[model samples]
Target chain A: MNPSDDAGRSGVSRRSVLGGGAAVAVAVPLAAGGAQAAPAAEAASVEPVTVKVTVNGEPVTVRVDPRVTLLDTLREELALTGTKKGCDRGQCGACTVHVDGRRVLSCLTLAVTVDKREVTTIEGLARGDRLHPMQQAFIERDGLQCGFCTPGQVMSAVGMVQEGHARSDDEIRERMSGNICRCGCYPSIVAAISDAQKVMR
Target chain B: MRAYTFTQPRAVREAVTQAGTDTAFLAGGTTLVDLMKLDVMTPARVVDINRLPLRGIKLDRDGLHIGALERMSDVAADRNVRRDYPMIAQALQLSASAQLRNMASIGGNLLQRTRCGYFRDVSTPCNKREPGTGCAALTGINRTHAILGTSDACVATHPSDLAVALVALGTHVHLVSGRGTRTVPLDGFYALPGSTPDVENVLRPGELITGITVPRSMWAANSVYLKIRDRQSYEFALTSAAVAIEWRGRTIRSARIAAGGVGTKPWRLPAVERALTGRPATPDVFESAVRTAADGARPLPHNGFKPALLRRTLVRALTVLAESR
Candidate 1:
């Protein structure tokens, strides 16, 4: 099966159902005039923008509100929840994803701004059933504890290695400081990245 | 976050024309989007300026000309910047996280607001957030507040580490609008928080930052940026110093010093620079020169340590630069 077809198959049905329910919810209120009518009237006026993005080598087009973040769009619209949102602010690295081959915090990036860019999320890292080398190394080295920050850690590690700044352990730690593991899995994470460095090369 | 219209402008003229009091220019959306989420900044329309042809890094006979839209990570990783302007490179590298650095532009970094807790929380009384509201940071938690160029209306410190280096190296900020183009000294670009704490910069309503030109100087080659933070990485500076000095054998010909995290704006130390000129590059001279750094500092209750910290940071940066020679 094609990757884009798989993504579209999962996204189309869920969104259509949600869209139908939302339209009914808005219609019923507008049909009945009350104090609740004002908010529903305002909701109707908001223009939805169609954004075209290449996700995981798949061209995914979706209409989202301009306020929706790239992180929310990936998780909610495309049903790719591999990218977690730790802090909606840019402070945390949990929402890290590759945009045009560079790492960026998706929570702070607007979905519409990345119109036709290539976005590679955690789900995009694997090749069929085979896990990425970073993912394999993380498991081999026990690089995670709670696993909440694991996806971001793996993504950031891959980006760090690709940046070629993590030549030594100290440099690895410094460059990888954006992603936090509150479970104190620093040593293991560093070891896994160090091991993956050789294999990735 | 309030819903707003996002329009991508292809040219500088369209972007400036679209900008108004109720509109904002969005480039690399790191700071603007964060503030919009926090409800600190509410814009009816956000003009996307990323598509404008303002992204370039050039080294010419004048000096280094960096586009305002250049990413912080790209600027830091530039070979010319790393070799010739170590202070700028170090400052850019030491700012924010790697993810943020990759997304944030140089222009957005300069225009980033303070990290004051009250300013970010919309419910609180912050003069910066809503002018005429009382400043909660004045008597509340102010450990990270400013000690220089501060007034009763506001005390939040400028948070850009890059601005400190730019100001120290005598960079020129190029501004363009429908009116025309003009250049301003980066040092004087930031407005001091006097009675009007809301007006943070000298930028007009429709003006756009085109790029910055850093003049090549003998001092730029031997410059250094030292930042003192609570953590080793991915943290804002408690106090930072950017120093560039020119030495003739054993004597100092000229010096440029600027500090961050302790001033309402990027604080330039002309007095210290003057004190170092013609002076021998020695520990005693550095100590005496830095003593004048806190000449007009008005320390708050929780920030009494900042004046001392600022002086120590400058001394340390000067010591490192001197030792490198």
Candidate 2:
């Protein structure tokens, strides 16, 4: 018998067994059945959670699903698309944002959890249309190629400098290892962060 | 992620009372939120414990007392921790990324699960993820699996670099439950995967980790944490060692050693420590003593190099510690 059939015969929970290869096959039929039960599930599951957060510098209130991550809330709800989403998983630092002046992965942070905390995204790095020092340094040093990971790199660099751990080049690279630039722009990124540190100091 | 009701508990008593089989206490949400997204952990209720007054890091006359809610970055950057317990700082610095270090809590770091690919992917049959389901890492891509602690059920390595250092420092975990407060040695906090792979720790249901206390010792000042990994930064250890030695002039008075990434839990090397006591603080002595580290190791097909690597890591850590001061 197939694994799913075997799983069923063994008295395992369907959801537990559905985690395997047969998920796709089971999901289609499950979705059809779920559609009939959608209204009831939606009423129970989609209860909006209200959260008040100070994004960038402005305090704002938003009602979102409890499952909605801070990254999704920032990009979709607040229209702060500067914070990129490379890998929705916490592995990539593409969704790095400062919550209460500390860098954290936005994809892993539930929006409801950070309810009264101050959040600083990439868009918050400037003062009235003037580029932040790190952003200026990134441009001057050509710290980015393709520019997808640049926002995260710049934001993480800001956080790193604030944390005071980037005293040397090796330290800078180590501290900034979270933001991965697959375009092989690491040398330039390090250069940008180094230059930004001098100005920041 | 499945929809779950969230409650913020203002007090530790309230958090403990709210916790149950279907509930999970949220700290940094670095690991818990990630696992929930993968559907690996689907707690029906999430109790936010951040509001609880458990964030303290102080070096008292007795020892270093670290609150459970203290963030990893804050603890690593603490002046007392950096001066007296350098191994703790080094281990925290070498873990995950800077972003994660800032987000993860000291208690949450100790409780972080394995990074085994099979356990992470819900589609696979992982005994740790679902008991009675066979472990895929036993025959699959298990280069990162444990060699020191392995059973027929699981081979996943404990992923915290900080835990290895804490175990070496002889840290004590203080836990609080509705019943009362109790303490367990850090080495005894983790459970080895014997017949049941699902149960990873000895924490009772509704029990909360209040803090950890590391007793003051002269050996901690000379401690070092050496981690070998695929990359120099932002990668988990292949075989890491945390070594702390107390030296009186040229003779070693006492030694403590622990290994990570090669064990189901943080593997303490009492044999290696016993072998180093009274021996002169020399490279030859360190090299000879570390040989006993792999005595009881059960290396797997893909991770046969771990025993040798673990030994070399211990030697390197000891050498660094001996050379310092």
Candidate 3:
């Protein structure tokens, strides 16, 4: 059994869960092979952990399982699916979101833990339908191939620009390494980021 | 990923009181959550330790005190840390990714589990996950496994570049349990690959890492991390070196050296440090000192590149550090 085979046996049968190493909460269920999907913990069993999340400048209140992932909550409950889920295991950055203005992988975060904090997803990157500079640059530069890792790349680029990490190509590559473009369109990706820096400036 | 009770304690005392035989402290959710998804770890109850008021970054006489809850990105982005402690910042920056660094905590990085394939697979019997079940890596395809400090039981390398840097910085970790708070040298955190490969760290059950402290010295300002992986970014190290040395005239005042991707833990090369202590800051000296990187190395069939790569990384890291200084 190779490492990949071992990883495959660990609930990933087809794809190699590689890319973002952290921020992936892969809750596929326990090794209870025959155990029916445990019904969502009932309200009675659920702790009414009041999570006050300030999302994209708007304060919102929601009741969540202490274990509910920020990714699923934002997508399924909040109807914000712009943050796609390529590899739910945090190996892919498709679900990257911003926690307090810093990019974080939503799939790996617990909703209850981020209570009383600010959360930002790709859906919040725009203002009145005007795309963010990074998003615009990506469109103009064709940074994406299949558009799966685009949202994450865009979010990360926005973060890099805001954080002043877009000074050099090596830095851009080091910073953007978290988002994987399966199409191997890294040259365009870097170009888009460089363009975004100028556009945002 | 089986649904387990998520317990958030207001304090470490309460959290330790709540931990049990089947309980696991959930930190950063970077490593633990992924394992749970694979059914590799099943803690009936998960005690979320993030909200325990254990977050801060401070520098004192001993070293830098990074609370376990301090996000990796915060440390990397901190102006003071970047100015005074470049090695720590570089280590944190060179880890997973910006998104990951933002979510991952420094304490959690220290406690990160191995990236071995068998341990993550449920169908396979990984001695690390289920002791005595047998180590599949022995006969299995193990390209990313360790090439140093390997025993027949297990040979997994500690994966954190931050840890490798921490070891080189001579950092000590502070832990809090129900009993009291105490500090342990980073060198003692990881256990040797003995029969019980299932166990990883030296911390007792229910012990929580509260903070990591590194000594304040000129060496920290001159430290650097050089990781050689398959890809330029977002990949675990094929081999890496963290070198923090202080030079006085031509003699070395102090030298801290450690390597990743080739050890059971973030290997602190005291041999290399001893070799470099009185030597001049030159390439030949660096080469001779680093040649012992794998002195006791026992490389598997597929990992022969490790010893040589480790040497090259050592030279590269030293050059980078010397130039930065």
Superposition error at B245 for model 2 (Å): 0.7
Q: What is the docking quality class of candidate 1?
A: acceptable
Better of 1 and 3 by lDDT: 1
The sequence of per-residue lDDT tens digits that candidate 1 reaches over residues B1-325 is 6656678889998888888778888888888988988889988888889999998989988999999999999999999999999999999999999999999999999999999999999989988889999899988999988999999999999999999999999999999887889999988899998988899998998789999999989899899999999899998888999999999999999999999999999999999999999999999999999988988899988989998899999999999999999
The TM-score values for the models, in the order shown, are 0.93, 0.91, 0.89
Top-down TM-score ranking: 1, 2, 3
Candidate 3 lDDT over B81-155, as tens digits, reads 998888788878878988888788888898888998888887988778888888888778887889888888888
lDDT of 2 by residue, B66-143 (tens): 999999989999999999999999999899999998889999999998999999999999999999999998889888
Better of 1 and 3 by DockQ: 1
| Regions more than 4 Å wrong, model 2 | A1-43
The CA-based lDDT of model 3 is what?
A: 0.80
Query: Which candidate should be chosen as best, given TM-score against the real structure?
Result: 1
Q: Report the C-alpha lDDT of model 2 over A62-85, residue by residue, as the tens digit.
A: 776666788877765666777888
The CA lDDT of each predicted structure is: 0.87, 0.86, 0.80
Per-residue lDDT value at A193 in model 1: 98
**CA deviation > 4 Å runs, candidate 3:** A1-50, A57-59, B323-325
